[model samples]
Target chain A: MVIAAIAIARIHDLFAVVMLTGIFSLLGAAAYVVMDAVDVAFTEAAVGAGASTVLMLGTLALTTSKERPAPAKNVISALIVVVFTGVVLIYGTLDMPIYGDPMAPIHHHVADHYLGKSSAEVGLPNVVTSVLASYRSYDTLGETFVIFTAAAGVLAILGQSRLPRRHHDQEDSEKGMVSSPEKSKGAST
Target chain B: MEQFPGLIPYWVIMVLMMMGLYIVIAHGNLIKKIVGLNVFQVSVFLLYITMAKVEGGTAPILAEGIKLYSNPLPHVLILTAIVVGVATTALGLALVVRIHNAYGTIEDEEIDKLEDQT
Candidate 1:
């Protein structure tokens, strides 16, 4: 994953970068699987690697592929900010519980109750699903609405009439609505 | 040295997080920034999943004989976050397409220059 991330940072071609990001997400999903989070791995693979790559490629088709080199001054400032943030995060980690420690506060607080009671209460095999869809269904509902709002926002911005016809062609292709077969035949003939 | 083994994963996550932050801060391309943001979000997902892991536990699916299971709370929360993250990515990309259509360039510096001129 680290190697993929380094490649993504160094590579300038947007297509290559997009492909690398997909690989990176897949690697993360694999890591999740190793950590016993199969559900997370599934969602990560489907959303992070699948949908995100397609969306980014569509954006790339509508825009340029090469990134303009950032100004030298900006690079230095960015490096400084990143270093500071990293230091703070590392400091924060010093007090965190070790990996897979069963006695960790997070595991004891609410997770234990869910793990104990969810199968009986929710009558589901998958505890994660039970918690998400039944125990905390309100949060899930809000998240669904959030996704709805985001889709609405995208339509508002890039709807057919909002974009010019040339770019609208790209959007149409995105929706799998290409020119009719007769139009294609006429153009070819 | 005693604490080193347990803390190693956190250090790696920190490095990955910083790399994403650098890309977002240093890169000028709008799409690249979005990619960086996704990378950053993935690291956070890893962080949460890592915490939820039990040394020898299986997944949270109930079974007849299985006694140990990884924490389900983080998995549930991250599942919602993953969906939201993708939605945000889609919206951001849509906005990027509009920016390109309006400005003819998605590079940050060029957009600034165009805005200054206008």
Candidate 2:
């Protein structure tokens, strides 16, 4: 995954970068599986690798595929900021419980209760599903609305009205390769 | 060295997160920035899932003989976050397309130059 990220940063071709991003997501999903996070792995594969790649390709179709070289000053400043933040984060992690420790604070209270009672209370085999669909249904509903709003926003921005209209003169200048404006107008309508 | 071994995953997480942040801050391309944002977000997802893991635990599906289960709460939370992340990515891409159509270029410095001229 780290190697893929490095390649993505160095590659200027937008298409290859998008492909590498998909590979990175897939690698992350595999790592999730190794950590026993099946549900997260599933979503990461489906949403991260699948949907995100398609969206990025659509954007690539409309935009230039080569990245302009960043200013050297910007790169230096960004490196400074990232290194500072990473050091602080590593410092903070020094106090965290060791990885996979059952006695970790997060596993003690609500997680234990869910593991103990979810089968009886929710009567479902998958405790993740019950917690998502039953115990925390309101949060899920909010998430659904967020998705709806995002879709609506995209549609509003990329709607038919926003699409560039092919004019008759523009078509004539292009050796009539494009269909007549009347035909395009008819098809659009 | 023993303490260091336990902290390996966290160090990996920090490196991955910083890589994403560096890309987002240094790159001028709009789509590249979005891709960087996705990488950053996925690292955060990994951090949550890593914390939710239990040693020698299986998936949180209730089974006849399974005694240990990983925490389901973080999985559920991250699931919603993943969906939200994709939705936001879609919206961001759509905005990028619009920006390209309007400005004739998607580079941040060029866009700033254009704005200054106007």
Candidate 3:
């Protein structure tokens, strides 16, 4: 996963970067499985590896596949800031309870309630489902509403059912294949 | 053994998060920034799951004779978050496509230059 991320940073080809992002997502999903979160692993694999890659590929078809070389100055400064923040965050994690310690506070209150009472209360084999569908059903409803709003927002933004207009015609054509207005207009007409 | 409880996972996650931050800050490309944002998000999700872990625990499913289970709350929450993240990513990509349509360029510096000339 780390290797994929590093490669993504080094590679300027947008297509390869998108593929690497999928790889990264897949690796994260695998890591979730190792950590015993099957549900998250499944969702991450489906959404992260599947849906996101396709959407990004569609976006890549519209946009330039080759990223312009970044100017040199900002990168160094950004690296310094990022390194500093990274150190601080690592230090902060020192205080967190060790991994998988059942005695840790996170396992006590709310999680305790869900895991202990979920089966009896919700009568479900999957405690995660019970919590999501029964115990915290209202939150799930609100999240469903949030997804609806996001869909609405995406439609509002891209609802015209049109491919992106080639705005850079006067400058340079990155893809060369996606010609000017006439070709993009083909879909709508 | 001792290392699992040590800083290894946190270190890795932190480094990943910082890399995401660096990409967002240093790269001028809008799409790459969004990708970086996902890297950052996944790392944070991993952090939550890490905290939610219980030694010798199985996935958060009920089964006969299975006494220990990893915390379900974070998994449930992250499930929702992943869905929401997908929505937001779609929205963001949609907006990015629009920005490309409007500005003719997705590079931050070029867009700035164009705006300045106008």
Candidate 4:
């Protein structure tokens, strides 16, 4: 996994990054397998490692791969924030339960209800799916909205483009392509 | 055979994860940062998968006399996460490519500069 990730990080080539990302996803899927969640692992392996990486690579084909030089002014501030975050995470570790301890509050809590009763209540062998799709349908809808929001955010950030104004004659000649006010009026007639 | 309890694997995973995170944080290049992020994610994936193993759990399938089955649920969840991760990575890369086309640089700093100029 480390090897795959490093392959992704150090490479200047966008195609290589996409490939490494796919590998990283595959590794994640494998990890999920070990976690005893077979269906989730399968979905992750197929969708995350396969389709998404390919889509990204296709997108990369339409763009450039070179990076710009970093400005020096904000370096110190960035470093400070990163260092502080790292320190906080390290401090947080002191309070974390040991890996896979059955007695951990996380494991002992509400997870049991989902694992034990979700199948009976939701009538689905895959409790996670049942909970996500049924018991928590509203949450799932909200999640979809969140995804839509992300798409909107990206579009809002990068989608504005300048289009050259067209003369009446030019617009008329390319009748099928560009719809002008005159054409709309004609169509209405 | 120094069996230091919970030391080796944890340190090993952490080191890899930190290195990956460092690359993503330090690199200004879009491609490089993605790579670093991939590395960081992979290390965590390994840790989670490794945690799933029990001392003598058998493969999670039922055969004639197989007494134990390793948990299958984790595998399923990981699979889905992997799929989602792939999709996100793909979309991100696609955006990077588009950004490169629009801004003429794959480096984050350069892209920012171009945007600022506009």
Query: DockQ winner among the candidates?
Result: 1
Per-residue lDDT value at A171 in model 1: 48
Ten residues in sequence with the least summed lDDT for candidate 2 chain A: A180-189
TM-score of chain B of each: 0.97, 0.96, 0.93, 0.85
User: Residue B38: error of model 3 in Å?
Assistant: 0.8
Off by over 4 Å in 3: A160-189, B1-5
User: Using DockQ as the measure, what is the rank order of every candidate, best first?
Assistant: 1, 2, 3, 4
lDDT (Cα atoms) of all candidates against the true structure: 0.84, 0.83, 0.79, 0.53
**After superposing candidate 2, which stretches have Cα over 4 Å from the reference?**
A160-189
lDDT of 3 by residue, B1-118 (tens): 4545555787888889988898888899999988999888888888887877899999988888999999999998998888777767777776776677668778999989988987
lDDT of 4 by residue, B1-118 (tens): 2334433455556656676766667778776666566666656665555454443544344344654334344443443334334434443554564455455567766656666875
Report the C-alpha displacement of residue B94, candidate 1, in angstroms: 0.4
Each prediction's interface RMSD? 6.3, 5.5, 4.9, 9.2
Task: Looking at model 3, give its docking quality level.
Answer: medium
User: For model 3, what is the error of residue A130's alpha carbon versus the real structure, in angstroms, after optimal superposition?
Assistant: 0.5
* Candidate 4 chain A lDDT trough over 10 residues, lowest sum: A180-189
For A1-189, candidate 1 gives per-residue lDDT tens digits of: 999998888888999999999999999999999999999999889878987887787777667788767678888999999999999999899888888888889898888889999888889999999999998999999997888777767766666334454323454434422212211122111
Output the better candidate (2/3) by TM-score.
Answer: 2
Q: Write the per-residue lDDT of candidate 3 for residues A115-172, one digit (tens) a residue.
A: 8877788899888888888888998898878777776665566554354453545323
Give the DockQ (2 decimals) of all models. Answer: 0.59, 0.58, 0.54, 0.23
